[model samples]
Target: MRMMTCRLCGSDDLTGVVDLGATPPCERILTADQLDEPEVTYPLHLRVCTSCWLAQIPPLITPEETFTDYAYFSSYSASWVEHARAFVAGLDLRPDSFVVEVASNDGYLLRHVVERGVRCLGVEPSVNVGQAARERGVPTVTAFLTPESAQAVVAEHGKADYVVANNVYAHIPDVIGFTEGLRTLVADDGLVSVEVQHLLTLMQLNQYDTIYHEHFQYYTVASAQRALASGGLTLVDVELLTTHGGSIRLWAAPSGAPSQRVSDVLAMEKAAGLHDISGYIDFTERVAKVRRDLLSFLITAAEEGSTVVGYGAPGKGNTLLNHCGIRPDLLPYTVDRNPYKHGKFTPGARIPIFEPERIAADKPDYVLVLPWNLRDELIDQLSYIRDWGGRLVFPIPTLEVV
Candidate 1:
């Protein structure tokens, strides 16, 4: 294969981190009418820059194609909503503070900001979720973050005292441009907070399922510093979060002294060999083990004549299912809390989608959870499945039957 350019740095020296072959756009669930039509798939390979150590995939799909009419709504998960609420409550903001959140899906977090009587706005690219945010009293602007779009928001509402870009830093292919947009929207002295899945956790814990088309890149502290500096921001501090398997909540500003957490995390990354390409050596093997383990369990259940179903329709699940070649024969069908996916099928896997209630109704012997990151939340919600001697299967980190 030809060498690919690193989007974070202009490096042509990228080596494979792990390749899941190819998959359909994770979010592109198929309606019944479209099932017969040819579905498009792209390279789901994750590569790390030898120069900068930024893990990235090729920008084969654009943000517009995926985000303009998004299906994933933030409000669907109670744990995530509570996480957002607590995060908003923790910020030291007075009544006069203005806040902005990029990729603010359905205003799940901003609504809490609004409840605090602080002025807030959401920059969402998805029309459906943006409208949902507006309906909930979170003033939302439906547009992707470009420098010009950021300037327009700044011109109208004045600069934000705080800029929040949670779980979105990894979604953009144009790394510098998106960071510049964040910089433009923030005040000269304002702090910008970003939450992204930690690259270290992903590699060490075998969380390769997160490698999908929408997520264009991943970052180590060393690489993140370079990306932030390109857009005139500095990494001030870093907080390790348990959200999304593991994540880093980056606290940054126009300038500031590096915090102890930032230094500690950087040192940890270096010690783990993530400072260079050495840390990525065994990732593909680990990923293959996860695939083999999950497929073994599913095939065993199929031969034993035990029924199995899936728990969630998350994008990560789509990547896992498609890569493992799971189908309705093995999975039968999957369920999700989001009504938008009720009658649809997973993009490449073609497993039928239903409501969460379907698991209880069908009384399947086992339910394979898709969004294993929310294992605790799902366990409580699906506890009733225990009534029929049912079990939940988690495929990542390791295959476990709970």
Candidate 2:
């Protein structure tokens, strides 16, 4: 196999960050009948470009294969919905302002825009989720946002005043083209807000579970600035957010003066040794510790005759479960709020998924939380488990029980 160039910078100088072996697509929940057949897996090695500092993986899986009828619905989490609502409250928009959200899953964000009477459209690629958005009265077009598709959106709804691509920037393999698509979607003076998991947090905190096939690239503010400039967009400001463990929200436009926060985050990345790829060297060790710690905990618990189940079947959870080589025997079953996943199984772990009510009925001894990023919210929701001497466990960063 030939060495592949960096997905964002076109640099041939790609170096290893961590090789997560091979994992099945995290969102490809399997039916009982299909599990008996052959299952597919893809390489999940993440690397950094020496030239531009963008961390990425091989584009082994295409967006269409993973997102056509996607399993992730954003509104299932009450906190995430409130996060969207709060974000909408801050945006400077009027009733006449047109808004567009790329990869808008289930219209979780844009429904707030509709509530404000702001003209809005969702360019969602997932057919099932797009229908859900439409059913909720949020106008949606079910297609990927390529340059041409962006033009189609403009032809119908005019250029948007605000373009929001929350949690979707890292999903595309064609980073440059997708950035250009964002530029094409917004007017020259309009703004584009992007929220992607921060590479700095991914390293310092050991968030290796976010390194699935769907997330093709990870960005520091420096690399993100370069990525924005690739499509004639300029980063004006950035906000450090707690979403997805830790994320950076970039505010960009065709032209603008950069803000102090941009320089501050770049400086933070520099101080953290991420500016020149030195920080990536020890990451493999950190990720290994997480896997070992969780396995040790689970094995000890199982030996003690404790019932261990999982909470929330998020994509990041799939990466952690597969990397740790966890099987249904150890984890037994996991519960998710989305009914779509009720009878399905996780991609590689093959742990059965059930509705959220299963935990209350069974009163398991421990519930290993897969989506630890939503720590506070999940802790509050699952606090009732304490009534029956049940405890919540988190796997990533560190293994902790509360």
Candidate 3:
């Protein structure tokens, strides 16, 4: 495999941060029979550039290869849809603004934008999802958002007045090409809003599970600004969001574009230690502590003869479970609200997944909440479990009973 250059600064000055070794695709759950085959593993190593402060992995898979036959469905999570609705409604959107979204899964967000009288287009590689978005009246292009495709969009819809890319920046292997596409699609005065998981929070919270194959780059404000600048774009504003444990919602535009929020956000990140490399160097130790705490808690619970079951079959859940070497003995079954995943089993650990209704019937003493970031939401969703005196457990940042 070719070496990965710094996605932010385009420099080859990168050091090996960590290697998670090979593992199955985090979301690739299998049936009992399908589990007999060998699992596919991608390198989970991260490297940082001294000059740019960008943390990233090599682009092992292209968007066409990974997304054209995509399986992820955003509408599966009710909270995710609510989040989309809130984001669209909150923006100071103009009725005539042409909105474009990369990876617009099933038009969850774009539909909301359209409902408010904005013109919208979605660039999605996944055929199924792109078609779905189009079905919902969102003009969608069923192709990867590359420089060429971006030019086409510019020609057809005129330069987009607003480009919304949520959780899609890290999925691209050709970071330069993808950003170049953004440059073409975005009008000179238009803004690009990108939502990515914050690296500082990931390290602070020990969110190693977010370091999967799909997430090629783990972004910080400093890293993001550098990447955007390289493509002639500027980070004009940023907002720290609680979604996905922690995320940074960035607004960017061409360097000459005017936005009062730019310098303010840059100053804020500098104050928050975004420019310091030592902070990342010190984070590995904290990550190790989280691993130790989670293992100890799970081991103790198992020893105590507690009937442990898992709630939520998210990709992060698979990473944590596999990293901790958890098997069925520690957690017999996991429940998922998504019906698509309920009847399947987790990728590496093969933990059985059942519907939430099975929780009371099985009468598990403790339910390990896998989507710990949404503990509040999950707690409310599964509050009925408390009726049977069941307690919720979460393992990340710290292992604690809820």
Candidate 4:
């Protein structure tokens, strides 16, 4: 389903940025029984809105089909857990102040808020993670955060002092509705913090793998501010983060002046040509070069009789694999810390997934770090691979063996 209009401003003036070709749902890893069945693939093209400069993909698949049984669990990454803790610690919240996290998976972040005696509720759409959150003593509502859902939450739990939307902003197709819900759920002076992958970093670092069906939109500070303004919110402050390659944590309020950081970030984006259509013209070529570079490296490795396996089975990894058309012959298997992904095959690529210990047992010649965003942590964890003279490979930014 191609989008006829821009998701943020509903402008028909959309320009083609990059077409990653058709790809299976990024997180739709298959079991042995389901492997034989035909898998559906959707177009993974990105369009930049000329009016708002928002780079986005059409909502090809429904939210239910993509997220009802999510495979990506937040708590699996230890560094991410510590990042969440630090975020919670930075907030000055009273014990009675309510903090609501949209798309809070398995209570990873909210548990910190709960530990501080601050009231917290998580609006999670996936039943498995929602249940997991409940089990972890985090009150969770198993529903997508829409305007109606927001109203209901406000009625039950009162207006939230802080509405945290971390890394889930890009997954939503109904951008306006979700933002409007944020307006309704938050109090007049309450804060709404949204963290999303920065579009500048994606284009600058050639992070084309992040483009997928689940991520309906890619945001720059300018585009994000305009989208938030539609929901009666003002972009108050901005904080740049190194997570997910690079991301921007936006602090918005119903009524507040834009901070210096917000102005500076927006100025930087403007200076970088993100506000114009011409700025995105080179991205397609860059993405193609990345694909060629990776394939060349993998082919060279195969010719040298070196066995290569993947480190993580993340959604971004699936996109990278499918886009590069890598199969088991080049990269035999991948290991993941998340047990849910074990015993499953990556979507489209059909690479087998096993526990991280499998790398130790098999001792593959090279470990392809799939989730390149967490390369540091993965490198440290799998340092023993170096003991066996096994090198680590990173596909994004450039094909490099470290």
Please list the Cα RMSD from the true structure of every candidate, rounded to 1 decimal place.
0.9, 0.8, 2.3, 1.1
lDDT of each: 0.93, 0.93, 0.81, 0.93
Model 1, span 66-137: residue lDDT tens: 999999999999999999999998998998999999999999999999999999999999999999999999
Consecutive 10-residue window with the lowest summed lDDT within model 2: 2-11
lDDT score, residue 301, model 3? 77
Worst 10 residues of 1 by lDDT: 1-10
Q: What lDDT tens digits, residue by residue, belong to model 2 across residues 342-383? A: 999999889999999999999999999999999999999999
Q: Estimate each model's TM-score.
A: 0.99, 0.99, 0.92, 0.98
Error of 2 at 142 (Å): 1.0
Q: Model 3 lDDT vs. the true structure?
A: 0.81
- Taking all chains together, the TM-score of candidate 4 against the true structure is 0.98
- Regions of model 2 farther than 4 Å from truth: none
**Pairs with backbone N, CA or C atoms under 3 Å apart (clashes), candidate 2:** none
- 2 versus 3: better lDDT goes to: 2
CA deviation > 4 Å runs, candidate 3: 1-4, 256-274
RMSD in Å for model 3: 2.3
Model 3, range 333-370, lDDT digits (tens) per residue? 99987776767899888999999889988888888899
- Point out where model 4 deviates above 4 Å: 1-3
